[model samples]
Target chain A: MAASRERIREVVDRYVGLVASGTAAEIVDLYAEGATVEDPVGSDVLKTRESITAFYSALEGLEQRTRLLAVRIAGGEAAFHFEVQTVADGVTYTLAPFDVMTFDDDGRITSMRAYWGDDDMTIG
Target chain B: MAASRERIREVVDRYVGLVASGTAAEIVDLYAEGATVEDPVGSDVLKTRESITAFYSALEGLEQRTRLLAVRIAGGEAAFHFEVQTVADGVTYTLAPFDVMTFDDDGRITSMRAYWGDDDMTIG
Candidate 1:
């Protein structure tokens, strides 16, 4: 049985909300046990839950916020384009990346890969 | 100066329109002289305009159609998610892919990389 488009969208919305207000552990809870993530397309894949959690944990106190610009859900997959704004060293930075996420039968993210480059970063 | 968001979107919309109604040569005209393309993220890059034109030409007479699901433009870049429906060998197929396209200073597509996999294809 395939996941409904509404369910996939709800999961993506919940993910954006969690990234805004939840802890790294809480965010990891939304993924399946053996999920993987590859951010920035050509980068090394984060293969285990621990690594993925650590990656999120590093952003714990960065005052990061995301705005969903668009989202498309088909079958058990959802892809979205969004803007991430963060502040570091007294400078504000905006990163816009498109992420394609695949979900399991239980609506947990099984894999995620973000496509962006250094050129996509904007500093203000 | 960066290209306006409206310009980037117009280029993308024009590209879609050309793909739907124009020839492969016309589609290639939307790209810059030395633009590159990598369909399906990890594939070998199509380095020259000729190869890229050939790639599009192969789709000729296939009755390919694309429905834009969402598009996001920032700075000189635009990313879109769309569904491509086609029929081959008496089987109808659907492919939903997210493509990130970068534009040059003149609003011509400089690079395009599509994100998708075998799992994302459906046949009926």
Candidate 2:
């Protein structure tokens, strides 16, 4: 169990690094084949790997970076708080998001739910 | 700074304990006199201790319990994921909420924002 917890933590750290480096293709590889993502809690779940890959591809063009503020892992799941900085239309924006993710026995993310709303974004 | 992080972590633990014990009044006391809360990200902010107290009072009649899933603290802020179990009208409901909170220098919670939606609830 302890080893599994450590692996989940490593996966989370790798996620941050990959996002900061703009390696979108590599990011998708960290998830299991049928992983689902529901960003912003109330939104529709994105289930297809193709759609998930495309969702990450959108990040490739943006000058974006992520800084992890906090992380918690337990019961084969992890939750983290992070701040994302991005530039769009020459304006810098900061977004704070809290994400809860569950992993399978193989340490691949099976499901991810991000919690954030427009109110959590700030223009810099 | 480290001491402040420890204090914040302690406060978060206290919050979980108080909620589990059904001590709603004392839970509100963990906040500063004028702390603000937005339990659901898109909801209107609740300001003033009286209003906050009343909001918590609503918890008193429910058979509720909280189990901490994860906690992270940094930069005078903390975010945690937890499961809330409550019985209403003889039905058991489970809620999963991710909360981000900022604390004042005095170790009191200055602001709390909970991220959850209707989709996050499960009835048993």
Most accurate candidate by DockQ: 1
The residue-by-residue lDDT of candidate 2 on B7-87, one tens digit each, is: 987999988877767556798989988899987754779998888888888887778878887665544677788889998
Docking class of 1: incorrect
Over B1-124, each residue of candidate 1 has an lDDT whose tens digit, in order, gives 6567778878888777666667899889889888999886657899998899998898777777787876656446677877888878888899877877988888888898776667668899
Worst 10 residues of 1 chain A by lDDT: A69-78
Across residues A6-77, which tens digit of lDDT does each residue of candidate 2 receive?
798899998887887756679989999889987766577999988889888888888888898766565567
lDDT of 1 by residue, A1-124 (tens): 6566678788888887777667999989889888999876657899988899998898788888888876666546777878888888889899877877888887889998776667668899
Candidate 2 colliding pairs, count: 0
Task: Name the candidate that leads on lDDT.
Answer: 1
TM-score of chain B of 2: 0.92
Q: RMSD, model 1, all Cα superposed?
A: 8.6
| Residue-level lDDT for A87 in candidate 1 | 83
Model 1 interface DockQ: 0.10
